[model samples]
Target: MQFKPVVALVGRPNVGKSTLFNRLTRSRNALVADYSGLTRDRHYGEGRVGTYPFLVIDTGGFEPVVKSGILKEMARQTEQAIAESDVVIFLVDARAGVNAHDHEIATMLRRAGPKIILAVNKAEGMNKVQATAEFHELGLGEPVPISSAHGDGVADLIENALASLVNPVVESSEETSMTEMDEEALEQALATEEGEEVSQELFTDHRIKLAIVGRPNVGKSTLINTLIGEQRVIAFDMPGTTRDAIEIEFEQGDKKYTIIDTAGLRKRGKVFESIEKFSVIKTLQAIEACNVVVLVLDAQSEISEQDAHIAGFILESGRALVVAINKWDGLDQDKRDWIIREFERKMRFLSFAKIHYISALKGQGVKALLKSVNEAHAAAFRKLATPKLTRELRAAVEQQPPPRKGIFRPKMRYAHQGGQNPPLVIIHGNALDAINDSYKRYLESRFRKVFKLEGTPMRIEFKSSTNPYKDSEK
Candidate 1:
């Protein structure tokens, strides 16, 4: 496997590092905002500039002097991204001019330098050339004036960055590791257990793709860090520390998994920033792309409408779901009891989703949460034979037949499994269009109960069976 040259986008917060990142990758994966330090982790994305394919790492704002708290951790992550990268696009805000923090970051990058490409972002038109004059004091090189927002001079910056990596490159060791891991992954095929044998097909053929999602500040990033046993993402006290959908691949006990950490979503009224609006769309896209979605909720408070909205979207997308209540290590028994009662009253619709109370900070109850994630993935991909599906549909209709609509009684003639991954089933019948939402819900419930699809979504499609003789008659 050939390794793409890794390029690190380093700068202070809100300096258009993420904006430049989005421009380069052609993806709004990173969250962008006017607020400082919105991005607290190193987000990785793949991009190409004029056929030059490369990897890009968007690091959080680089505050060089912070010695304590989350800023220190952010500094550490940014430095690590720089160290691993072959080239660094040192982004600066032309609008802000040469600030103290920018100078500090410049000094740090100069000392621990890679091939640095100085980019003066937000500099457009005639001001572009003059906007880079102040950055000359940083002593990196001639600043590449570019507008990340409008794609002005961005391609030139990328071209220069890739040009620096053309010659004198070392062979990567990632290919060797991949070869060894692939061999090991294949060796576990059809391995025998203590008594019963577990098929390695679960590990080889399909790896669980899980997404961690919830409202802002609900420990979604923390839970992913705990599960992966690494601080791969920046988890901070800030309400929206994570701004992008970060995907990390790893293996546990011979089983492969790709976990996605998405931006926390707030209600539309509260969401004011254009950047956050983009983040919301990315989170929704992530939910649709994943096999399972872990809906993390704050255990300290009752479930809110934001949680319900997020859940409704997940169920509507027909993705597997796991409800994880975080911050469960502390609190009195009464609060726990209240949470249960609140769920029973407000969230009974999610009875199909397995719920776990966990402390993401301390990694409590996380293993069981992952077990549920795996089970839910399997349930979502379950395939039912034609005969079995027809029988189950007949049983479901017998229990609660669709009520007569005025003069006509909707009939469920037969059913068959149309697809898997949220098991889509097609129900053929006469007057199926008359069946209302209530009947659809009833059939969905029956499908879950009969097929044992406990923690995943199931979809039902109604179709009016066509008559073959109609073409000749017409």
Candidate 2:
């Protein structure tokens, strides 16, 4: 399989590597921070510079002589990044000039020897040339002057990096993902006669894009790893270990899945560093991209404000939802009862979603979670014929008729399914705005029950199709 050429950004702390990464990818996949050593892991994203398309890996800021703690781990990770990359962009702060840390990294890069492109960042406008002139002394050749934050001279840096790629690998995210054929289907396909075109309609990727989201250290990554049945993501005890939204695909039966593992979200006041702020941005974006979201909560802890905030976000996004309570293995009956009660009190707005108690560490109760996810996704795609929808509407009205607004008894004309994925039902009437909340909710519940839309949200829109001929007659 052809893999895209990898370009890595290597430099000392606080030198705009993540900013450069975001700019290159045209996405905020990598968290950018003003403080040093905020990035801890390798974040890979696809980007193009003019004619060159490549995979960019953003590593934690390289600290030369660190021996232990998170910094040491970061240094080790950066080294691994260099070894894997085809081209390395050594970003240095032009304002600060080249320091001992820069020399240390440059020496290592020279010995390792990838296509070294020196990027002198924070150099913009008329002073760009003068600021970059000193970097030539590092013996790496000309330093491409640019401002990562302002998009200055970034194109030249990309062009220099592109010169090294001989046969560029053009691969999509799906191709890179781990996709397996369903066992029974795979066996059937292999048994087909040679050159006889076996129909591939069975292998079609009707995969649901499910995103797992929650607060820090809530086992988001662990839950994802369990769901995919692989250690596809780094699950650590440390908070903020996952810095980007990572996508991994796998197949079960005929259902393909692209599961998105997002960085943990924390409340704004607690988010001090710039990196943490960026991580929150990445999480929100992941929710927007997904078809269904699994909001993981720590069963051991009480439901905090952040939990409610995250749940509210999913409801607002209009995505199908499954609330998975993680770390359920050790919880006692009392704790479980409390957890269930907490969800009930907080998530009344999202009563449509099904909740699953799961132990991701032990792989318990996950199969049921998958089942709920499937049902929810299928419901989102549900389409109702107009005649059937109208009948259902009439039935609903007869059961609980619309309330009179002063003198006028609103006439219900027609009903139709406008869209799916939180199935949208449009009911045309004279004064839909006057439809009381209780009646509206009653209809929503009735429709969900009739359509069997469990573990998925449903929306009912009251559209007023006023009769124009009534006023003309008067």
lDDT of 2 by residue, 18-87 (tens): 8999899887544322233534666766565656766677888888788888898688667766765678
Instruction: Give the clash count for model 1.
Output: 0
Q: How far does residue 443 in candidate 2 sit from its true spot (Å)?
A: 0.6
Candidate 2 wrongly placed segments (more than 4 Å): 1-205, 230-244, 264-278, 469-474
Q: Point out the worst 10-residue segment of candidate 2 by lDDT.
A: 194-203
Clashes of each: 0, 1
Which residues of candidate 1, in runs, are more than 4 Å off? 1-204, 230-245, 263-278, 467-474
TM-score of each: 0.52, 0.54
Q: Which digits, one per residue and each the tens of the lDDT, describe model 1 over residues 22-119?
A: 87877744322122343355665656455566667788888889998888877876776676567889988888889899888888877875788898
Clashing pairs in 1: none
lDDT, candidate 1, at 111: 80
RMSD of each: 14.0, 13.7
lDDT of 2 at 439: 86
Best by TM-score: 2
In model 1, the worst 10-residue window by lDDT is 174-183
